[model samples]
Target: MQYRTNPDYWNQWYPSDLISESFPGQFRNWFYSLLVMATVLDNSPPFKANFTYGTLVAEDGRAMHKSWGNSIEFNKAADKMGVDVMRWMYCNHKSENNLFFGYNRADEVRRQFLLPLWNAYKFLVNYAILDDWTPNGETLPILDNVLDTWIISRLNQVIDKVNTLIQNYDPFNATLVVESFINDLTNWYIRRSRRRFWRSEQDNDKKHAYAVLYHVITTLTRLLAPITPFVTEVMYQNLVHSNNPPQHIPFEGEGQGVMSHESVHHCEYPKADLSLVNDDILDQMSVARQVCSLGLSARNQAGLKVRQPLSKILVHMGDYHTELKPEFVQIILDELNVKQFEIVSKVESLVAYQVLPNNKILGPKFGRQFPKIRQALVVADHAEIVKKVNNGESISLDIDGESVVIYPDEVVIQTKPIEGLAVGADKHMTVGIDTIITDELATEGMSRELVRHIQALRKEAGFNIEDRITVYYQTDGDIANVFDTWTDYIKEETLTNELVSGTHAEEIFTKSVKIGKHEVMFGLKKI
Candidate 1:
């Protein structure tokens, strides 16, 4: 393989240092930079040094080779998950490290993240259309509601994080922040606001909710434009700017159109106005979230579901009382399906439990010490440990006659149960549960499960959101009684006009239908 032996052929083809870059190398550099720039433009601040650039060679210094079957072909990946999903994978991956591509990893991304996001987006579109939601030309007004302001602040925060990460070549963090936002939108924002979208026209709050969500969806579509081009474009066309004519946004350079044709790519990244992001507001919200998580986790552990309504939840706010007070109290009550959140100062009322490390502030310093430090800290008094840690005191330990100084950086302090409360805390957060589960709560849980099943049936039956329907019950006993109790819920959920008690009814061919347990049938007709 010596080039010196074949002087004529080798010399003509390969010139040292003067040879043009290989197609693969050129493509990689271009693609990598494009993604990096897109991310930078999404957030306002630049990423740190650790976030920038990655090396291509393996630790052994070998270039990845295709003949060795170690290289990934983009076209093959595109064929499998569609181009947008592939693009998302690339945008989300850690840019500071060489990415090892494989079929399995790609499949995992599609299944665990991409598909869920797509499904959520589809759900939003389906419901929005059904509700005949359209954003009135009014701009959003500043509001005192935490939900409203929190979402806007979060949107701006995402823009900042994404831009900084992208600009600094930290695609991993960028991707993570965006993914978090998507989860928030689907699970919290949309789920909590579903009733507003479905309410009657006379409800002004419904209109305001629609407007807020509309702004959010539209802004999200634009924000995601660079990462998942095709999907975002499709979403934008279907959801936002639907009345306008189609227009293409080019990837690079200066371009203009009759309208402001500044591609979302070229648009300035959004800046976070500090006035919008209130730490106190966020802390209160965290309390609400903690309470909700505890209740939900408790429900899951007890084999109870979210639809069940508890009579009350006692929140043991040892140190967090003032923080969790009136602000998020109502939100916690709604999220936990509890009638009230009784704030308790003592742990004596708690019944069931779980404990977790408070690792957020402590993990960075004490991660190296691990099990030994954790053990010692667990037995120590909470107030004493807190005082020492806050005062910057260091504890000395004798390990094999060698003095080891356990500074604040060498140990972690966490909360532990001494008495009554049913509690749980994880690395970053904590929660507590109520022990009692009532019969009415169980029935409500069953009702919720039924609603989920009916919704699934409707989707499977190809019923559109605007479809009006009637449900027929053919069963007796508990299930029948459950349906009877929640007839109005079923009607609202299925967009049904009626729910008949009878088993048999004349069917219309044009109508969509689904049959469930014990020959219960759901019939749908487009209004």
Candidate 2:
């Protein structure tokens, strides 16, 4: 009847397809069947329709029902957590799988993805404002740093993955790809390159960082626009249109183009730059990160904090481990607070090994021979057993004149740290930390701790990152000597223009922290 009333509307837009309704969606097919029966009886054409189906489940893997009192009040959730979060959760959740909707999940999404993305953008904007940086139509500088190149490559890969996944109607994987890229951009790329932005000079390196970050954020906004419209549009407006006028599309006349809307929805989707994708460097970086992580874990097990200095970390890798370059190894050194790093062919000197029979399998297989097998394993030369295992060989023991060959899988190899070493290992690699500390290392650690305190005071005092301050620290003996020895390093790190050796006025921010065994009082005054 409506089509008869508006025939032009029917000609332009007829036979609309319906989306998957919440529950009891099979009724749609019944209604469509009625339309078919009517059309057949009247000798008229039936309206074309399409049906999509999915199951709806609640946060606890149960159906949403008012009788069960498990129904979600979406309006209340939206009021508390924004609509973008709900939309993000839905898009990232696979339709084939049940969505575990809850406030906790929403909070995780906020903390993990949204907060990091926002913080990255805020970091750029804050520094850019301080530097008076404005976006110009200039290409990024040729950056030789692997961190920069790696992130660019990862960004392009993300673009490709997101486009493909979305095109294939897999919004779950598409949003997941974006989430991973955001993590890389925030934690790996921005974190490693922060010093370039922190520098007072607006050099080419700083410009390159800015260009990369700006391009990434803008492209990310465009990519996320379809799934998360409101938040992306707000970000696009603030990040892009705030600095410059709205972008324009070329019109017919020369120098005449219509100004485009500032909404991210209006922007075009990002295409991957195949030239920037480097899988090899990414692999190397992944290895380096793993090494650093293992090294840090070893230190933690040794009760050595990262603020303290260590002498060396010895790394032993499996056959499949990626060979890292000197620069990549340098990342380990810088991050692990170690003076030296060595890639060793053997870890016999660093780790002691013990071989034991796996009772779960051996208990039933050998029966009476188990005792002899256990004895052989206990008395077996651990070094030889380890060597055989490392070479992918098994150990053979003659038990009561009977030869029994025990495969590596039947034995458990437990690694114990040798003297003066702390060890951590995964299936792919092992890291050993030399826990020896010298006077110099202790002094440096103390100085670093003191620097942390002073920096915290600066923040408490509302001092800007670039603000200079006068430092007054009071401590005796070795710490005083530390101050004398590493005075320049401390001053440079804390932006201290004046370093005085006295108890200053109490009006200035003052705090006392235990530096080693000595309790030290420190004060900072903004200069």
Candidate 3:
């Protein structure tokens, strides 16, 4: 179909920039035919690039079969797993791998990725409405606040990456990068920024925090619009204030809502705000996040819940070069709920290396003598074995008078925490927790626990987030003593006007809850 011969019909869509379809079958069918027709007509291909996607299979790597009860009807899957979940699962996966789509996988996608994103949105919207914070302008705000700077920098970086990935049709990695940003946004940024939002004064810092998050989320909606049309449309409409937004959206007041745009699809794909990018903050935050991760791991290793405060953390930056500033160190300490932290060069005082056989990979290969091989590995020099495994060397072992070789992949180098101090290590760094909890530390942990209960009570009492309530407690012994000792701390956290000693009004909400080993009755009354 030459456009020169029949201009009216042929010029409508003569050459597409790209074509995408399922692999081999498309190559044999429509793809082959389209190229043939285009070549015969004008000596060219119809599209500049061709993308082929892989097939879907059951989770067990078998074809979908009704007889085997391994198949899912489209409507059933869509209705149960949700269209957004299915789309996320598809987008998050590499196009060349067989996608094992099922309820289980979809549930994981919802829990692992979508849940955090949704929580962040919910947190922002709830707090925004509580404080009556609305997007004032479209420009990204530059702030001197460490968290504000770091998150904005991250937002710009993702904008650039997602734009590039989308242009190249690399949706898998693009979604992955977005998910990582979401994790940082919810877990790190928003968690750290909560106090800024909760402060009594409506300060410039608070406004900038909301603005940065608003920009990040709305821009993300625009970027995700193509892939998740329904959710993104809903999110954009609900999140952004628009005068003419649909009735169902979360729009309350009208100013510059939606910037006169009706839908997210109408908005321009977000461009990276290069002016906001700070490589230094990004690098520092990266190390900070990884350090927090290892610190949490150490806490888990020590059977210590985050609610139980630890004394300190000892971090060894094995190869990482970023120097933790005071603020960055403060973030790690606050996040991990540790008192102090020290940077050390050697982690031997915190962790011990041991070589363990990967039973799964070696089990089938050395079936009968696997136990003997394991025994040999157990008696081997731990440090030397770790060195060999790390360097990709194989170890020779004697089992029943026969020499057996253990390859690097057949073993795992494990870092065990020291007996009293729990430690977690990875390639980049090692973090060890001070497992010794002093009386003061335990009391502080108790205070944090009380804060949790007070927040829950506020919610249970149908009180608004900004509502200040006087707290009443009736307890004896340590529970009562903790309340008296940390009265100001509790009041500061729960927005209490007063910490009363007795019960509340007969009509107000009161609940007796367990703290540690004893029960304490708590009452709340709105003022």
Whole-model lDDT values for every prediction: 0.59, 0.78, 0.82
Question: In angstroms, how far off is 342's CA in candidate 3?
Answer: 1.3
Candidate 1, residue 457: Cα displacement in angstroms equals 2.9
Per-residue accuracy of model 1 over 1-527 as CA lDDT, tens digit each: 24558768854543222222233454467445644764664532222222233444422345668676566566876787688766766666655456545566667777766776677667666665676655434345444566776676677678767778767656677788988887777777777766666665636676566556655665666667777777766666665444333443211111112222334444433444556566666667666776688768756765555566766676665446455657577777778777766765544344322222446644665567545545555554544444455567866544446565666654444444334224554432344555465777766666676677667766767766566766554456666787888888777776767766654446632222232343344444334
Give all TM-scores, in the order shown.
0.67, 0.84, 0.81
Residue 143 of model 3: what lDDT? Answer: 78
Per-residue lDDT for 504 in model 3? Answer: 54
**What lDDT, from 0 to 1, does candidate 2 have?**
0.78
Candidate 3 TM-score versus the reference: 0.81
The backbone clash count of each candidate, in order, is 3, 0, 2
Q: How far does residue 256 in candidate 1 sit from its true spot (Å)?
A: 20
TM-score order of candidates, best first?
2, 3, 1
Model 3: lDDT to the true structure: 0.82
Q: Is candidate 1 or candidate 3 better by TM-score?
A: 3
